[model samples]
Target: MPPDPHADELRSPPEPFSSRRPTWDDVGRVADLLAAAERTRTGVVATRAEDVRVRWLMLDGLEDVVLVEEPGPEPVLVGVGEYSTELDLLDEATVVHVEGQVHPAATGRGIATHLLDLAETRARSAAAEEGAETAIVRTTVIDGDDRARAWFSTRGFVPVRHLLTMRLSLDEPPRPPTWPEGITTRRFRPGRDEVRAWTAHSAAFADVPTHFPLTLEEWVEDRILRDPAFDPSLTQLACDPDGEVVGLAFCRAGVEGAPEEGWVRDLGVVPAWRGRGLGMALLLDALGTFRTRGLTGAALDVDDVTIGPAVRLYERAGLRIVRRIDVVERLTSTG
Candidate 1:
């Protein structure tokens, strides 16, 4: 047989990368890697180092998180992944959330696959440890990313929910929020209003299918109190005549990628206050607050399946759908 010219090329292996459990010291670089990936994929940078720190704090430890890097004098992070599990006590199911991202330059090099494998392994172990009767693993991808959709589909995940990222520009004057009669608004008081706000949120979202009320401690620890970007002055609470919280607007000064824009982290009205247009008032109040802060825009994400009222209220307040994320899940175990 004649010598083949491409045999050497076929024999050569792909470039090598290293993966290890992430540590607190890696938080900033992980955030940078994630931000870079987001920018390459969506032209937006929303992963701040603080956000990454909060996420790591939520985990039991950093062992479940993996970071992939190109080995060199100054190693570059090319991929990252993590998995966490929550036991749905009411539903008797364990929900595992697997998240991962790879640098655009490293796509198709099997980095994502390796990360996903690690995430799933951690997920399964966590679910088993919780002794859940059923295990479901979930992940999310941008709505229009067909490659990502196909990747999850082949891995047995099916699209289950759609979340809309809505944005309202503050270039023009925003419509002033009109409070319902006898209802007044005030800024959140860090020490005094934390429990009250949590109670209000839990009541407001009680009917939401995907929402499981977090305990006051869990709620406070998640993002509101711990996030360095949380500005109490920017967070508004609508109270009835008796000084009870009826509605709330939780706003963050800025998100990781878009500091010029304010983030409406949460807006909700209790069921008793729902029909009085308090939801719209809270939303507008958030927008107004953002505008007053000199932010160029305001943004928030809503679950389309569960929060129809929120979507309509946001649209009425001039926020348009800027992006969509699809949540996909796989039922890994029936028992």
Candidate 2:
């Protein structure tokens, strides 16, 4: 058989690294870039392929939101950035969330700046279309990453919130959960529990900082149903004797990179149920679920700056502060 003439073109080196819109084909390359960046900082590839894929699919503008840098023949991705304008779902304000990762080796080349510029332009344009009263661009930085924090600070981003990422080792069995009087727990009922769980979560975070109520549709689409990692068996809900959902511990199991870790994506107790141990019981139940699934540990995040006791509650439940993250925002509009 003769070698195909097009075979060389297929194996040919790629063009010089440049920024361009991403496609489904870029998911793997983008995941690699994110994983490499994660390993440099945390010694782990926390950003899994599923995370990238699901996030890309969930964002408001799939095509305009993503940018990647392909460097060399092998087409190794060195940078990723996404601009999202879905904050209108949280409020009428035009707020865009800008998130991205840059390869550690690719720093100081103006890549980050260029990405931010592109994101801001996209965000502002989206905001204008929405006729928003105000436009804001937001991003987060790990508290310990001085370089990242400085980079954003130099670009006029102001820190607005401090989030604590907590972790608990399951090597030691968690204390027996003591449910409050008249409260009972069970795994979520797939179709029936969606709205109920959403209600419980919204009520739980209502008093927290920057509280934005998510509509039932938004709640189901973004946080619950769309995630491939969501596990109803691991999601514990506390209900009253009459069957009212008073608390919840929504778990996300089988995260791509951290297979042995279960994420307590949302753990909360309704206002009336606070201080009755409902939250603690719900959290312990989630941990037990993880343990039953043979996970090594569990993790969750809280806005410690705003909800001090929420952090205390997790600490008392045996979770320690593994890291800190800063939420920063910049106004894209002059007025």
Best by lDDT: 1
Model 1 residue 327 distance off true place after TM-score fit, in angstroms? 1.6
* lDDT of every predicted structure (CA atoms): 0.79, 0.76
Regions more than 4 Å wrong, model 2: 1-17, 23-32, 35-45, 48-51, 60-62, 65-78, 89-91, 189-203, 214-232, 240-244, 305-307
lDDT of 2 at 26: 82
> When superposed on Cα atoms, how far off is each prediction in RMSD?
8.4, 6.7
lDDT of 1 by residue, 1-335 (tens): 44532222122223588766677899899888888877776687767898888788777667657677888999888888777778756557777787888888889998877766655555566677777545777889985567888988998889888989988789997888888999988898889999889889899878878787788899998757567887889888999999999898888977756779999887888988879988888887788778888999989989865557678778898989878889898877534
What TM-score would candidate 1 get against the native?
Answer: 0.74
Model 2 lDDT at residue 298: 92
Candidate 2 residues 89-142, lDDT tens each? Answer: 454567778787788887776667767776576566767777764578888897
The lDDT, on a scale of 0 to 1, for candidate 2 is 0.76
TM-scores across all candidates? 0.74, 0.76
